[model samples]
Target: MKTWSSIILAGGMSRRMGSSKALLEINVQTMVELLVEVLTPFSRKIIIVSNEKDYEYISSLFQQALHVQIVTDDPLYQGEGPLAGIYTGMKELQDSWYFVCACDMVKLHPNYLVGLQERLHTEIVTKRQQYDAFIPYSEGRVQPLAGLYSQQKETIKKLLDQNKHRITEWLTHMNYYRIEPSEWQGWTPISDVFFNMNKPEDYLQICRERGK
Candidate 1:
């Protein structure tokens, strides 16, 4: 029930995939299009961060939606990875909370956000400590791209200025609430919900699995 904006990181080089993952089509919808569709209901604004070349094309895709904004990574932090993407998105929108996702994720589970919101509300009711981020831990790793973040642009900027661009590394400096398997497994299996395509074969595998 908190004010939420959505940020989709779409600027990866996609070197392994051999093309822009954001532009990849599933059935008829591009990855970004699918993400936008799923996120619209929960977001007041949706920001897609791509590189310079993809900016115009992505912008054209969402011209009719006033709440969606397509942007290029900031000139200073361009190509710096997911941390830069997160900073660019948080900088673009002033919303208090942001649901950040990677464009490569094929089947993002909306229930994750719904459950996280409920947990946050419970914390408020019980007067428990809160955190700057609500991240998921799956397969023994933290999924920062699938996390919800508080406005931490300054923290991100400081880290990037110091030449630290890894998102997992940046998380160490923030107070975060980690959602483990026990907390999220009831909604959906983490593997299915957070399956990200890193190569052509991964895409093919996902398509085959989904009967696409």
Candidate 2:
């Protein structure tokens, strides 16, 4: 079976953090940079979608990956959220599945991703399934932002046709599978690794955790 591709969703408004969340630094590296590093081994390609103004700095981060496209949304589709980025990335990628991730998850543990990897391998080995989506649920809730999508070209067109702009809303319309967090062992703090930067205090706390 062919390996799937990935796209990192980096266009959040980051209102509470009061700046671009994609640019937030943790351990001397930008959040998006860290995310790209993690996904580098797994992705066939990496794409970034945000306002052109917001991406100029980020575009320079990967000097070697000229193959990784950094795209700006068409003004007509401004502020439509992560779904817009997902649509844009899926349109350009040839892979049947795309692993999409949010940039703000700095505390993310590698084990969570390993769990998803195991699922992919299982699907390939057992069912030989052709799923349209794969999302993980930790403690009964789905993390739509951190999930794998078998982003079929036809389904993407349907989503665009419906004018769906929310990730959660569209996930409801797809044929997908969700795994309980416990299904995977060695999973770390559900909250710590998923700590979303909300305010100045959150950044301070994360800095302290990093021993800064």
Q: Which is the leading candidate under lDDT?
A: 1
lDDT of 1 by residue, 164-210 (tens): 98887788888898899788877665456877899999989877876
Per-model CA lDDT versus the true structure: 0.87, 0.73
How well does candidate 2 match the true structure in TM-score terms? 0.87
Clashes of 2: 0
Off by over 4 Å in 2: 74-76, 185-191
Summing lDDT over every window of 10 consecutive residues in candidate 1, give the lowest-scoring window: 185-194
Model 1 misses residue 55 by how many Å?
A: 1.3
Error of 2 at 132 (Å): 1.8
lDDT of 2: 0.73
